[model samples]
Target chain A: MSAGMPFYVSPEQLMKDRADFARKGIARGRAVVVLQYDGGVAFVAENPSRALHKVSEIYDRIAFAAVGKYPEFENLRVAGVRYADLRGYSYDRSDVTARGLANAYAQTLGTVFTQESKPYEVELVVAEVGDTADGDQIYRLTYDGSVGDEHGYVAMGGGAEQIDAGLQQDWRPGMHLADALALAVRQLGADPAGGEPRTLTGDQLEVAVLDRNRPRRRFRRVQGELLTRLLSSEDPTADVPVPDEDDSPRASSTNPQTQRDSERDQDRDVDGGADA
Target chain B: MTAGPESGRLPSAYLVPGSSSFTEFLSAHAPALLPSRRPLPPQATLDAPHGTTIVTVTFRGGVVMAGDRRATMGNIIANRDMEKVFATDEYSLVGIAGTAGLAIELVRLFQVELEHYEKIEGTLMSLEGKANRLASMIRGNLGMAMQGLAVVPMFAGYDLIEDRGRIFSYDVTGGCYEEHDHHSVGSGSLFARGAMKKLYRRDQAAGDAVRVAVEALYDAADDDSATGGPDVGRRIWPTVGVVDAEGARFVTDDEVAGVVEAVIADRRDNPGGAR
Candidate 1:
C-alpha cells in the first residue's frame, strides 16, 4: 500500500463514490419499466430469450423487475418474492408494500456489495398499486443496496437516462398502456442517431400489469397475443377485466374499482360465502 | 435424522448455519431426507409408471390449469385412473412426469415444505420464490436423476401483480424455465403442447381453457401410449387445477366429469377434433 496521502476525500465522499459506482453499473443494462394503469402498473421490458426474464411479481399487489446479470438479479427477485410472501403471511397482505420490500432488498444488496467484493450485479424495481388511483408506489433499488422511492414513473437499465428523458415527454397521470408502452418501446428502441423509435412487438417484449380495479391482490402478466392486442388497443383502461368467478376478489369501499368488486363479493358473501 | 460417514454425533451438517429455505436446510441437516439426495441403481430407468399430459391456459380475467388421468410404464398401461397431476401448495399446482412414486413423494414433500415455511416464517413465499425453492429441491435430486429416476414438474400459479397466471417448466436437474403463454410436461407433452398451440387464446375463458385441456389430453393419449385420456365408462378423468386472484382451486371430479362427458360427446361426432 502507498504511504501517507493528502486524504482530501471524506467518509461521506467514499460512500458517494460507492453509490455512484453502483449507479453506473446499473445504468449499463437494458432499461426496464413499470407504468401505472387504472387498476395497477404494467411492467414491460425488452428481453430476447423466453427464459431469463427481467420481470416477476413479489406479492399480490407488488411486482418486481430487474436489469443486470441474469443470475444475480434472479437471486434478488427470488429473495424479494420470499420476503414479500413471508411478510404477507406474517402480517396482512395489505402490509406488504413496495417500500418495505425495496428496503429489505436494499439492505441485503448493500450488505453484499459492501461486505463482499463482487457486488450483486443488478438493479431492481418493486411496484405496488393502492386501491385508489393515488395509492400507487414504485420503489427503485440499486445494485449497491440503496433504495429510492420513485413517484409517477421510473426507468432502470443501461440507457435509463436516455430512456427516462424520452419517457418524460409523454409520462403523465392517466396515460394508458398503449401510449405508455409506445413511450417505453420508443426509448428502448431509439438508435444512436435517434432515428424513428424502434418497433417492439409482443414477441420481443414482456409486459405485465396490476390493474387498479382488482381487489386485494394485483399482478397479472399480459403477454404474447394479449400483449399484441393490448398494444393495438385504443383504451385498455376502459376495458377493465371483470373478476373471474374463480377469483375471490376482496375490495373495500375505499377503492373506485371495488364499486363493482364489492357488489360481486357481497352477492357471494350472501351466497356460498366462506372458503371451505 | 443424520449420520456421518465416519464422525458421528448427528453429523456436522446438522449444526451448520444456512439460508432458511427448507429445501436447503434439509440439504444440510439430512441430505438423505431430500428426494434428489438418495442412492439408486446404476440405470434407474425401468418400466416405471410415468404420468402424462398436464396443461394450463390463461383466459381473459383468470387462468385454467389441467392434467390427464394416466400413468404408463414403457408400453404397458400402469394405471388407468392415476392422477398424474396435483395441487401442491394453494395458488399453485404441479403436474409430474417420470417416476410416479418419487414424483408423488416430492409433491407431497413440497406441499409440506410450503406449509412449513408459512407456519415457521409466518408467511407464504411468493409464487416465484416457491418456484425457485422447487428448483433447488430438484437440483438436490440430481444424483437420483443420473440414475434415471427423473422427476419433471410443470408449475402454474396466478401472479397477483400481473393478474395473470404464470407457468414454469423444469428439467430433472432443476433448471427453471418460464413459459410465456401455456405449457405442458410429462410423456405426452409434445402432443398436448401441439393441441394447446392450436386452441389456446389470450381471450379464452376459464371454462374454454378447461375444454382445451381435455382436448389436448385426448390428443396426447391418441398418439402416446404413455399418456392417458378420460375413461368415461369407469367415471375416471383428469385431475385439474385453476389459479387466479381467488387462489388455486382444483376442478372437482364432478366438473371434470362434465367436461370429459362433453368432450367425449364432441369427439364422438368429430374424430379429427373441432376447430
Candidate 2:
C-alpha cells in the first residue's frame, strides 16, 4: 500500500462518518432549550458570559439559539442576522420568515459539510412568533444541514436526551412565561436523583424570548434581578412534596433565608459559570 | 454548484462583518438594491407634487413638530390631506418639505435604518449619531437633488444624554445645521418662520408650543397657496408630534382638533397673529 494513496471508502460510509464526528463534537457542549408558550417562544441556554451570547435576536419576530463551537456558531448568528436584515430591506418587514432563514442556513451547512474537510459542530434553532399560537414556527437545524420542525419544545447539546424526556412531561401550551422558564431551569439542572442536582441560577443562564405582545420588535433578553424574581417566584418544586424524607433536612425549608443564601451562592456561580 | 449571481442564492457578502449601517451593507453586497443606486435620466425633472411647510419648536419638556396638509405642483393644488411629518423612531421625528414621494420613501428607509442598527449593534444609536446618519442619507440623494427633485427635511429628537430636546434642519445639498428656539422649511417657510419668530419663546409649556406650531402653519397657509391650513368644515388639522425624554408621540386628531379650534378663534380675533 502506498502511503500517499488514500484508502477507498464508500460514499455512504464517508457521509455517516462525517455525521457521527459532528454529532460527537456537538454533544460535548452544554444544553439549550427552545419552547413555545403563551404569547411567543423562549430560549434558555446554560451560558454565563454576558459578552459572548449563544441566544440572540435575528430579526423583529425571529430569534436564534445555537450550541457548539462558540466562534463557528457566532459567525452563523451574524450571517443569519445579515440575511434577515437584507431580506427585510429588499422586500418588506413582513416577508422575512424563519423558514427562509433556516433554508439558507441549511444550504450553507450542507455545502460546508460536503466540501470542507471537517463538518461544523453546531446545532441551531430558528424560532418565530406569529399573531397566534397556531402560527408559531420553530425549526431545528443540525450540523449536517438536516432540518426538523419541532413542536412544543426542542432540546439539544449535552444530556439532550434526558432534557428532552423531562421537557416532554412538563411542557404544555399556554403556560405562563414564569412557569415555562422555571420548568426549563429545573430540566436543565436536575440530577438523576439520590444525589445533588446541578443548580443553574439567573446569571448562569442566558435567557431571551420572542414576545408576541411587544410591538414591532419582539426579541428581548430576560436577565439580572428580573430573571431572579421569575425563578424564585415560580420555583417548580414549590408545590411538590419533599422528594425524599431522608433528604428533608437538607432539602427542606426553602424559606426566604435559605432562598437568599442560595441566591448568594448563585451569585458566586456567575463568575464560575464559564463553559467554553 | 457554481456561485453565479443569477443562481438566486445569497451573495457571499452577507457572510462577512462590515459596518453596522444597513445602507452600507446594501451598497457593498447588492448595489442595485439601494434607493440611491437607481439612475435617473439626464433630463429628469420630476413633475410630481411637492409637500410644503413644516414647523418645529423647542419646549420646556420636549420638542414639537407640525406640518400642514397640502401638496402643490406648478401653482396647482395637487392633493389635500397629505401628511409630511413622521415618527422616525421611538424618540425622533422627521418632517419632509419637498418631493413628497421621495421624502416618504426616504423616511421609511430611515426608519428601517434605525431599527437595523439597533438590532445589529444591540444598542440604540445616540441622538447625534442618528442625525449624522440622516445627513449621509440626504447626501446620497444629492444626485436627485441636482435634478430639481430636492428633499429638505427637519429632524427633531429628545437628547437623552443632555436631557433636552433638539432640532436639526437640512438644505437641498445635505448641509445640516441645528436650529435654536424654532425653525421651518418648505415653500411657505418664510411666512411660517416669521410667525415662529414672533410666537416662539424659551422654555414654553408643551401646550403653548403646540399652539405656536399650529398658528405658524396657519399663517404660512395664509400667505403661501401651497400650505393648507386647518379645514374646520372637513375637520382636517395639521399633524403635530411631540418628542420628549420619554419618547416621540403624535398628537391625535381629536387633541389637534381642540387646539385648532382654539387657534382659529384666536386668529379671528388677531388675524395678524401676535404682530
Candidate 3:
C-alpha cells in the first residue's frame, strides 16, 4: 500500500538532462537571426504572426530577439523592458546597456534552469547599435543561461547550426542594410536537411533594425513595401527605400500561407512540443 | 536605484503580464519611483520656479507650439531662457507651465510612457489615446497639485488618421479639453490668447502659424512681467516647435530670429500688432 521510492540522479546528469529538454523545446520552433551591418544591427525571424512579434525594441538603441515557446520568451522580453526602463529612470538613459541586460537574463535563465521544476525553453539575442560598425555589440543567450559575445552574425533555435554555417560563409563586415537583410533572409530560408531552400516573402518574415544614424531612438521596424523592395532589388549597393517621414507604424499585410503556418505554430507552442 | 535581488533575476512584479504603460509598471513594481508618490511636508507649499506663457496654434497641415524663455519665483526671475517646449515623440510636442521642476519631470515621464507603449505594442498610440494617457498621468499628480506644485501642459500633435493638426489642454484636476484652433497656458496666457484670437485664421499655412505663435508670445511678454520678451542683445529667442505630417521638429534659432526681426520691424511702424 506504499508508493515506490524515487531513485537519486547525479547533479551532472540532472543538469545535462534539463539542458537537453530545453534545447529540444527550442529547436521545435523556427529560427531567428541577428547580424551587424554598416548601419547597425538587423534581426530576422521566420515568424508569421504579426501580432505576436519575435523581435522588439528594448530601449533607445537596444533590441531583443528570441526563438522558443512564445509565452516564456514573451515573459522574459517584458521583464527585460522593465529592467531597462527602471534603470534608465533611476540613473541616466545611457546607463542601461545590453551588457547589463544580458547579465540579468543570464542570471534569470540560470536560476530557472537550476532551481525550477521545469526549465524555460527559450533563447535570446540582445543587440545594441553603436555609433560605428566596430562599436556594435551582439550578445546571444541560450536556454541554460550561457552568454556568447557574437560578432558579425549569430543564429538560434531550429536548425541554428545550419543557418550559422551559411552565415559564416556569406556574412561580411560593412555590408549595406539591403545586403545584410537579404543574407539573413536567405540563411533563414535555407533547408537544414539538404533539401530545396524555401522562398520567404515579406509577409512570412519579420525584420527590424537598430539604425545608427537615427536620432535618440534608433530602433525601427523594416516592413511592408520597404522590406519587399529591399529584398527584390537587384543591386546590392542600390539606395534602400527610406521610410516615410510619417512615424506611424504600418500594419503588415498577411498572406493565407503565413496565417496557416502561424496557426500551426501557435498550436505547437500551446502543446509545449509534446508531439515533437 | 532599487537593489538587485539576491537571485539576480528581475522581481516577480516585472514578469507579470500587465499594461504596456511604463508609469503603470512603475506604480505596480516601484511606486516610489513615480513623481506623484513622493511625500511632502505637511501644510508647506514649496516655493519653486514657475515657467510662464505657452501658446499653440493649428494651421492647415500641422500645429505650432511656442514658449517664452522665462521662469519666475515669487517676485524675481528664476531663470532666463528656460526651455519649456519638448518633442515628446516623432509626431507630437509638449509645452509645460507651472512648477518648472515638477513640470519637467512630468514631461520626461510622459515621453517615456509614449515611447514605451509604442515599443511594446509595435504601434503608435492615436492622438486621442495619447492625450487620454497624459490626463491620467496628471490625475496621479493631484496630490502634488493640491499643494500648489501643479503642472499644466499643452499637447499638440499631427493626427495620422484625422490628417490634421490637433490641440489639447488640461486643468489641475486632469480635465482634458480639446481646443478648436488655438490655446494658451501659464501666467501670460490671457494676453497670448487675445493676440491669437485676432491673428488666427482658418487653414493658415505652417509658416503663418509659426509667426502667429511668436507674435502671441511677444504680446504676452509685453504685458506680463513673469514672461520674458525677446532678448536681442543676448540673442535668446522663444522656443518654438512645429508638428506636421512629416514629423515634429524645433524651428532653428536663425529662422526664429528672422521672424522676431520682422515682428520688431513691424512694431516700429504701427506700435501695435496687426489687426
Candidate 4:
C-alpha cells in the first residue's frame, strides 16, 4: 500500500499562512516597552508573576527582554545567556556584543520558521548601552527572524502600534530615569489618543534597566517600594508625598484609602479618555 | 555548545541539562578547550618558571594579602615584575605560587567561574563557596601537578555571612585548608610565616596589618633567594590587597612606598624588625 499523496500547497500561500499564524500567536500576549533614557536603556513589561521574569541580564552590559509565549521566550533568554557566557569565556569580555546575539537569534528563529511546520511565537529585544547616550543600541527581533535596529523607543506585542504612537509623542533623547519610567508607565497604562486606558499597578508591571552608570554589570531590576514610589511620585493626583529615603512601609500603610483613592482616580482619568 | 551552522543548529550538548559550573560545561561540550583536560607526558618534569611566596593575615575587621614580585626557572630569575596577587572579585583576593603560566590561567578562569555563577544564579557565592570552587579548579589540574607543574593559590575574602575576613590555602593535590589568623605558601613561605607569627596581633589596625605584611615579605626576600625585596629604585613594591566589610581594595603604590620607606628607616636602627 502507498501513503496518501501530500497536499500541494503553493509557496506564496505557505509563506503567508505561516506569517499569519505567527502574528496571531504573538498578538495574544501583552505588550512590552523598551526605551532609551539619559542613563541607559530601560524595559517595561506587563507581567504579574514575580517568579517568572520577562527581562533578564545576558552579560555585563547587555540585557535581553521578550514577549509572547512564556516557554518559548524563556528558552531564548536562557540560550542567549549561555551564548554570551561562552563567548566571553572563549574571548575577551569586551568581545561580547548585542549585535552578535541578535544575529544568532535571527539565525535560530529563521531556521525554525522556514524548516519546521510551526514557528516560534516570540519577540525579543537585545539592548546594550555604551558609555555615552549616543552609544546606546536597541535591536528588535520578530517571530519570523526579522531584526530591526530601533532608535529612541520601540514597543512589541499586542497593541504595539498604539503604544509606539504614544511613545513617539512623549519620548525625549535625554530624560531622567524617573521621568522616563513615568512616560513608559503612562504609555503602557493608557490607550491611544481617545480610548479607555487600563490601570496597571506596580504589582502588575515588571521593569529593569541597563544603566551605564553602573560598573561592569549594567542590568538591574526595578521593583517593590521603589517602583511604587517612582510611579506615585510622578502622578499629581496621588496626593501622597514622596516617601523618605528609608522607603519605610509605615508611610505607605499610613493612608491605604488615600493610595486606593489615587489608583481609583487614575482609573477614572483614563476611563474618561482625556488626552495627554 | 559551539554548534556552528555546519552542525545543524545546536550541539547535542545544548539539549542536555548541563552543570551550573562553567568548567564542567566546558568539559562536557568541548573537553579539549579546558585547561586541565590537556595531558602531559608521564614521568616528565617540566622546567617552567614558578612564582613564589604568597602570605595572608586576618586582623580586627578584615584581612591583608601580599605577594613578592619574582619568578624563577631552575637557578635563574625568569621575571622580576611578575604579579602574583590578583583581585579575584569585589570581595576576594587570590595570590598564586607555582607554575607561572598555569597559575595565571587558573586565576583568570577562577574569575570567570565566579562571574558565571553570579550570572546564572543571581547571587554572589559565599566566601567558603568561592574557596571550594577554587579548590576544585586546582584539583582539575592534578595531571599537570604530577608533572611537577603544580599551582598552589592562597585565597582570602571578606565573609559577608560571618561579617569577618577569612583565608584558605590549597596544596598542589587540591587540599583546601582554612587557615586561621595567617598562612603562607611557596618557596619563601616559611620565612614569611615565621615573620608573621612574630609580628601579627589579633587587634592590629588596618594600617598595622599592612605593615606586618610588608615586614613579613621583607623577611622572606632576605631569607629566600627566589623572593624579591621591594624595588625602591624601580618603584616596584610587593602587591598588597586589603579586604574589609566594604570590599577588596588595592593599596596604592604611593601608600605602599610610604610604608616601605618607614620600614627601611626602622630597619636601619633595629635590623631585627619591630618587636
Q: What's each prediction's TM-score?
A: 0.50, 0.87, 0.91, 0.86
- Worst ten in a row by lDDT for model 4 chain A: A250-259
Please state the CAPRI-style docking class of candidate 4.
incorrect
Model 4 agreement with the true structure over A188-254: per-residue lDDT tens digits: 8886546888888899999988878654566778888777876787544221123223222111111
CAPRI accuracy category, model 2: incorrect
**How well does chain A score by TM in each candidate?**
0.79, 0.82, 0.86, 0.82
Tens-digit per-residue lDDT, B162-186, candidate 1: 7778889899889999887788887
> Candidate 2 or 4, higher DockQ?
2
Off by over 4 Å in 2: A1-5, A191-195, A234-276, B1-9
Clashing pairs in 3: none
Ranking by TM-score: 3, 2, 4, 1
Model 2 TM-score (2 dp): 0.87
For all the predictions, what are the DockQ values? Answer: 0.04, 0.09, 0.19, 0.06
lDDT of 3 by residue, A90-109 (tens): 76677889998998899889
Weakest lDDT window of 10 consecutive positions for candidate 1 chain B: B7-16
Candidates arranged by DockQ, highest first: 3, 2, 4, 1
RMSD of each: 13.9, 12.0, 10.0, 11.7
lDDT of 1: 0.69
lDDT by residue (A147-212, candidate 2, tens digit) is 999999999998888899999999999987788888899888976443677889998999988877
